[model samples]
Target: MSAKRICIEKDKKTSDDDKVQKVVINSLDYDSLAQIFMLLPVPERIDIEGVCVKWKEACQLSCLPKEINEIHLFFESLLDQKQTRSMRMHGSSYEASRELSAEVLYTIFCTCKNLKHLDIVHCRNDVAEIPLEKWISFQNLQYLAISCNMTPDLADTIVKYCKNLKHLRINNRHHIINTALKTLTELENLECLILLNCIKLNKESIIAISNNCKKLKRLEISIRSIYDPPSSLSDLDEISKLQYLEHLKLCIGKSLKDSTIIAIANNCKNLKSLEIAGCSAITETALVALTKLDNLQKLDVSFLHITDSFISKLKGLKELHCDFCEQLTEAGFIQLIKNNPDLKEISVLGTDSITIDLVIAADQATKHRTNGIILHIRKYDLELTQAFKSIIKSQWLVVK
Candidate 1:
């Protein structure tokens, strides 16, 4: 056999199409190898432990080929296992002793240029300061999620490197300011941005994001506080600039007004999905404006005060979630069943006032159709939390 054919056959046995289809990488095994496995599309098909063991053996035996693009080996754990060089770690939770070092992370970035997605969740071990010169290693990275203990400087370093990033989710417990968000503006291709439990992002940061991330299509924001004197919901104007936006989630626990909701409905006309949970300012006015949006398919207006009039107007809605809407009693719910013939899923997690009779009324209103109804409620009624569930079970019998 020819030399080339023999080499090809040997590599072919390991690179079988099926094996390539089933590769999963988990952290408990070779953390570095598992990361590399994540770069593969078929990581879900293969056994995660098996892939890690294989990579561990490959690294230990120094058997890794230089041209291997499918496998990513981030040896930060290995570097920590054997301290080589100093690496500056920036996250809030820094447990990696001077022994683990940042060289491993640096080395991985340098080698894995094809990394398309990167998730650094709750792992921040920076031993010494690494120069920015090494930051441009992971240029192809597209999806990046850094949560729990995000570092501001580290976030800048990542944005500088991953300029082509599409989805960015960062949760900074240390309280990041407008600077970090401004830095993210450079990622022109960013599509999905999530800032969950971030204590520092105020209205200014929100405005900056609206002005800069023009291409953003999906956003999840959790603001610490909203003014009680009923600050005008003018920040939505910034959101309106994002014409291509499809999904938006706003968790602002402040006194909101009807004008704010109207402003949002008018501006974010392209919104296919919307979630406004725990915003006490919203009322039937907001709900009324929302129904006018012909494109809205899924809506979650939980923990808000909506009356029977608003419930009756949602005839065009497909999926509706109204959990903990204390004011939404059986009268409003029955109105929803009677008015919204196209309704598919209804979630009433804490609307305890709704009884079994109301459920029957709802099912009857729907022409006794059981195929399209999926209700989520509690199992018992003794606890305050169980009311919604009991109501759902009682309603289920009526549907049949």
Candidate 2:
């Protein structure tokens, strides 16, 4: 064959190979493919369903096998495309090989800057492969809830990075010290703070949070012992700073005394909802002081040895919980009906002394009207117990 013919044939072969390579490369550049969908002709795009097919293919490849990094990258890309406002990572126990818990959180926070609400519920307590402290800042953050096992250091790191945090729920059993507690002071916008089942929390920690977060509106805390009354009323006094407080839950440890609780109620007069669970030392006197807050809508004096006097003071109360109050008798229920005519929702689950007959009579007398009352009877009743259990359930929890 002649030299010119041979050259022309070689050029045609190379041109065909180039076209094949271009098609293969285009399939891999996902961003370009996404742009192509945006630029498609109206009629052709409608028939093609190009965007839907691409997303389905991407999601199947990324989320199907449960690859952590792939899922993370996919979410990041989606965030960039859609400008995601919130994200929740719940029970994503898809084999995270990370070492530091804080590190994994930091990476997520960094990638998702527009994230306003973040929920990491029931995650592994073990440290991720990476530490969280290295991450810079998350300026636009507002709400954060980290539940289950977590280190105190990670909590501190969060306080440092997420300064504008408004709502925080940390349910960790680790020991939280003063330094870590003080970190909350930096969060000026913090509105709601919940620390559930944190065994190591003490009075000092509460005091620090209250003192620092002056704009706080709601706070839920659990201490080491209810009886061990905090020598410093700093935390109690801090309530006055939060003039807008609406909900306050103090699950005192075994060390608190009657006075400690009274002091709290007396100070936070504007409180709308108060739950004093596990505060065994508190009595009727504290309840009387609580009634002073005429605005009190919901009160849970459960597990405390309260009597009829306490029940009478809460006349306008809405939701009342008296669970585990073994000392309460029929007199309390009778007084409740006679006095608190507005009493609506009530839970008297652990009060074994009150019979179902007495409860039914009270409910009937009340006419099951507005401000409904629910008498959650115990599982077992004595031989002399009233047979009104069936009636009570039918009237309140079931029908109403």
Candidate 3:
């Protein structure tokens, strides 16, 4: 309690502070640092490497895609007498009272400097709560899939900060205005983009994406539902501008038709995967047009008016998803399967002719093959589906 005793204590505290300051991240060996890195979120762990050379090396060691753990330790041995606290002191903290995971965003932006992939889609935190413009720090972010109310400011923040973003997906929210979508198109390096079910996304937005993100390879757009989009009538023609497109999924109701399919076949020569689901206007002619694309490996014309004639024409397809084509006969479906020798997956989920007999017959046809075929049957087929698991196994996805 004396002044002399207090001064001695103060000197001791100052010495401890100096010791803490002297201890750098490189002071720890890779194994010890890697152990600590393993405890952080995967993105943060990957990002931590950007902190320093030692951390980067430790990160690499920690993320080895090997079969087993590199280090084996005795519990008692690991509990050494020395104990140390982490140097990171002035960052985000956890508290249950806060409903939004907005804190998670702040922590990542400030701490995880080298984050590569960020998929907070349908996240509990409304990113609108975070001032993304102010906290714009995703310098190394390559992939981002988020669901937030798409304000112009939010879109601008993404376009500005997310320079390295190669893949971008904004889903589920409505009335994503064309201007706002245009703002996001500024991400020139974008290779994969998904903007589905955005009612306000019309021709203008599509044009913007095609114009700006020239590097885009995979594009999925669904701006129209049963009714037309709120903006101008959907411009299916503008899609041809994306000459580099390799994979495209369109669920834009009537906006996707035979002409669009034909244009895609002619322009997007590299098109590999094409899905035209929930489009009522598309006739079997669309299938004929799609057959022109030599690189097309996967075709999904689910809920379309595809018949036995057109479905049989499809050959060498890796995957054929013709879910709920009520017009398709058992014989025709079998022929379709027989035609595609390389077919790995044929999903006939809701087609009326997908009977136990049809499945059994298909299994019998494809059973003796070296590479297995996956048959997606209805949930009611579970009993027989399970029975077929051991022999002539169809990788069944029992859909409702």
* Global lDDT of each candidate: 0.61, 0.58, 0.67
Question: Residues 317-384, candidate 1, lDDT per residue (tens digit)?
Answer: 66788888777777777777666566666777766655766765754565455566543333234553
Question: What ranking of all candidate models by TM-score puts the best one first?
Answer: 3, 1, 2
Q: Enumerate residue pairs that collide in model 3.
A: none
Worst 10 residues of 2 by lDDT: 64-73
Candidate 1, which segments miss by more than 4 Å at Cα? 1-107, 124-131, 148-156, 226-233, 255-257, 365-400
What overall lDDT, based on C-alpha atoms, would model 2 receive against the true structure? 0.58
Which candidate gets the maximum lDDT versus the true structure? 3
102 Cα displacement, candidate 2 (Å): 11
Taking every candidate in turn, the Cα RMSD to the unseen true structure, in Å, is 12.7, 10.0, 10.8
Each candidate structure's TM-score, on Cα atoms with residue i matched to residue i, is 0.66, 0.65, 0.68
User: What number of clashing residue pairs does each candidate have, in the order they appear?
Assistant: 12, 26, 0
Q: How many backbone clashes does candidate 1 have?
A: 12
Q: lDDT score, residue 386, model 3?
A: 67
Per-residue lDDT of candidate 2, residues 235-278 (tens digit) = 45454555567898877544555665566666766788988877
Give the Å shift of residue 209 in candidate 3.
1.7
lDDT, model 3: 0.67
